[model samples]
Target: MLRKKKITFVINYFYPDLAATSQLMTELTGYLQKDFTITVIAAQPGYAGENHQSKKLFEEGYVETIKVVRIKLPEVNKNSKVSRLKYISSYFFLANIALLKEKGTDVIFTISQPPVLGGLIGTIGKLLKRSKHVYSIHDFNPEQAQAVAYTNNQSVFKIAKIIDKLNCSYADQVLVVGEDMAETLRGRFEDETVPNYTVISNWTDEDAIVPIEKSEPAIRGFLETHGLKDKFIVMYSGNLGLYYDLENLIQVADKFREQPDIVFLFIGEGAVKERIQRYAAEKNLENVKFLPYQPKEFLKYSLNSADVHLVVNQKGIKGVSVPSKIYGVMAAGKPVLGVLEQGSEVQRLIFESGAGVVIEPQNYEGVIHAIHYLHSLDPGELKSMGLKGRAYLEENLTRATSINKYRQVLQAVADNSPLEHTFQPKQYKEVVHKK
Candidate 1:
């Protein structure tokens, strides 16, 4: 019998956490387990305040074949910038220590979790274990920090920029979540030594998140539980973070406050959750509702509960980040109202899939117009659009499609074979980063 190559993953969150990164890593590790002896070095999952028992080895049956090393670190309030910085610095130091403990591995894959710190740690893991490093840029660093105004200090930005550049050059392959991200990276790292990018859009489990009819028990029960039965729900599920333009969304919700049948739902957690709730309260907006992240098993119901799902990005975040929640919305067979920059990847996807409408950022009137247009559609016509989205998702963004691409990349990198490169850094002089 042939031995499988060893591949270690270094990330901040893993399985138990419902954060987008956690879900993506969990699925990736699970899918690659048969081909690679997987090892995950992650923090004790608590980004969303869900407590998990500390374990040095993630030998739990979640992914029975892989080995997981969970590092112990002080809990910090995510709302506090000082506390988050403390946590990031601590994790960077301790995670490197954990990586140094691992033995021979063929490749080390890491995501941009603590931004550039995670990628830098992957380099250390590669050097210590004598393995190749594959840097997965889930979201761009320094740029993402700047997008959200996470830090105004020039020194911090400079250090992040330097580390980011080093990680780009150090990795054997640079994996990005979207095409614009690939273009952006290729433009930034013009040096030939910098790793080539392969675009791998985030995916959803088709079988698990199949379209649910309103008559389905799961959907019915969810609506009943939330007192949303017979209401036309416009839901924005997943992270309510800094990069999202929710001010206009809130205003849109306020516009429908007098209409008893129109309910705006905001699900999941993030920095902006409380602000959203408070704003809705201040306006006495009775049409809006907020819910915490639902368990994975019940996600289909929560996701499908919305009549028209929303996916939003702020003005200037086109290439720097892509919201993963849109995939789930597509999987649920629901029409989307994408509030994003014009000509963005999200707008393109939504239009291409025929699943939703796109509105420019901060366009409160556009938001109102979109909701009314969707509301004006025949139920059957809306269902047809949703069905188109689900079909598009299955054909283009299914887990199998995504994981197969990853498998090929890993195999090619492992064997020193040529990758089916998607973007060449030298071809483009500038990448789009506009509002």
Candidate 2:
């Protein structure tokens, strides 16, 4: 029997981490395990406030057949640059060291976490191990950072951009999560040779997160437990992070405070989570509520509990990042109130699928109007609209479709052959569904 090729994944989050990237990576690695000898190097579970203290700097374990190496790092305070730097720097150094310890690695795979450092690990590992490198850009930094004004130091931004460009240049194959992001990658090498890249959309588990009736026990229980029973829930689920303009978006809740029946639910945690929480408290926005991240199994119920979901990005974030929560929202058959830029990937998806209404980012008036418009729709109309998104996802963006693409790409690269399959973004058919 031919031995399977070995691929070492150097990523910050893995199996137990509740970050969306962690879940995606964990799923992708599981799907690829049959074809590759998989090894993962990741930080201890911490994305969702899980405390895992390890005496050893590195602990090795297995998630089923896949080998995992967990690195011990200091806790992250997302609000502090100093704390973030310490966490990222420690992971970068320890991940590199872990990569050196893995034997017979044929490929090094990394994502754009911790900004450039994740890709840098793959680039350096390629040189040290004489292996092919695959860099998946989940978010393009410097540009993403600049979009939200995360940092104002042009010198630091310039240096970071240069390093990431080099990481791209050194990679054997670059993978971007959206078509808009693919354009952003091209912009990095204007009038120069662009790296070989593929646009692979991210996915949620359709089987696990199918649409359930509001009356379903799990759904009803979750709603009642959260005091959301029979309330008009407008949920924003996922990282309460920098890129999504969520801190500012939280202000929109105040506009609806007079409506006792309307509730704004913000779920998950991030750097700006506390800031938004404080604002809600200061304003005494009784209509707005915050919840911690739900367990993976509870997502289907929690997601379906919402009347309409908010998918958003900060202005100027058109191609810099695509919010992964959109997939879960669609999977759960929930109508969207999208605050996304025109022609952006998620915006286009919502429009094409007839999933929901979209407005320009930073247009608070538009958001307010869209929410009212959606709320005016009858329950059947809202259900039909959401089903359209679910149908679109089933046809074009299924987990099988994406995992198969990843399998093919990794296989072709491992064989040092040109990719035989050309991936074109699916032109989704108009999916009209009745409830």
Candidate 3:
């Protein structure tokens, strides 16, 4: 019998951690635990934005007996470059200690951006300790940061690109959250053989989340008490961070300040969350309401409660990523007003599913157009779209499909899987950075 795989499941967030990324990390690790000896390395239990904290020392570094190491983060924010760098730097500092110290750590699998620095560290550990490095790219940082204007100076921007590229090319295997992200990397990398790549769209807990039933009068009663009944609830449930383009979303609510029939709700937390909250308050954008992040299982309730679900992302940045929250929104079967690059993965998904409308991120113009168009539709029509979206999700984006895809890739990599690709980076941007 094959000895169980010793895998270091890595990320900056994990269970008892409220971020969506943390939840995803926890679930995937939990699912794979019986087959592998897994240890999760992540930032310790504190999210500055949410005022969230993990109170318990992870059950001997294991969450509910699930193996995990919570490396404390220094500081982080979407807008602060120094804060962000300090955050990534913490990963480098602790990864060496928490990750490298472990003996016979057969494979080092890191989950995303905070873990990008940790990924490089994992690569270093892989060499020093004789292990394989797996870098899972959830969002492509350098380009994503630049697209969002987080780093405007070409100097700092170039450095981020260099670090990002090194993180990608240096790994033994790179797993992406979507095919589009994988293609983006394939278009940029040279020695694709050494740094192997695979795609697994992040998934929802199909088993954990039961079909939503509005059984309780308390449920409808709560909405009624809040004057939210008889309205088309358009909800965006997750973090309001670097990619959210929330200022634009607030302006969308501003445009429709009189559209009382469409109730907008934002339920979650993040670096820019307060700013979004303040704007909503200042504008007296009565259509908008805010709630804190809820547990993954609890999310299904609010998710299915929406009339038209909404997802928003700034333009030119999506090629390097596909937001996993969009998948959850899709899984809910609600029509998505996904505001993104017109031809990007999300927009294409919206079109393919025939479940929702797609809006450009051209600021006010796009938001107004989408709102007006969606509002024009009959409630019955929107519900039809929701049904179509829900069915497509059950058919295509289920958790089993997601985990299986990942297993196939991991199996291939472990088996020294061979692949064929005739594409190369036509526009080779040599990355250069400074400290």
Instruction: Provide TM-scores for the models.
Output: 0.92, 0.97, 0.88
Top candidate, metric TM-score: 2
- Worst 10-residue lDDT window for candidate 2 reads 426-435
| Candidate models: Cα lDDT each | 0.81, 0.90, 0.69
Q: How well does candidate 3 match the true structure in TM-score terms? A: 0.88
* Clash totals, every prediction: 0, 0, 1
* lDDT-superior candidate, 2 or 3: 2
The local lDDT score (0 to 100) that residue 39 gets in candidate 2 is 98
Once superposed on the true structure, which residue ranges of model 2 sit more than 4 Å away at CA?
428-435
In model 3, which regions exceed 4 Å deviation? 48-59, 75-81, 190-194, 210-218, 415-435
Runs of candidate 1 with Cα error greater than 4 angstroms are 55-62, 190-194, 420-435
Pick the lDDT winner: 2
In the range 316-364, model 1's lDDT, one tens digit per residue, is 7888888998889999899988988766667777887888889888787
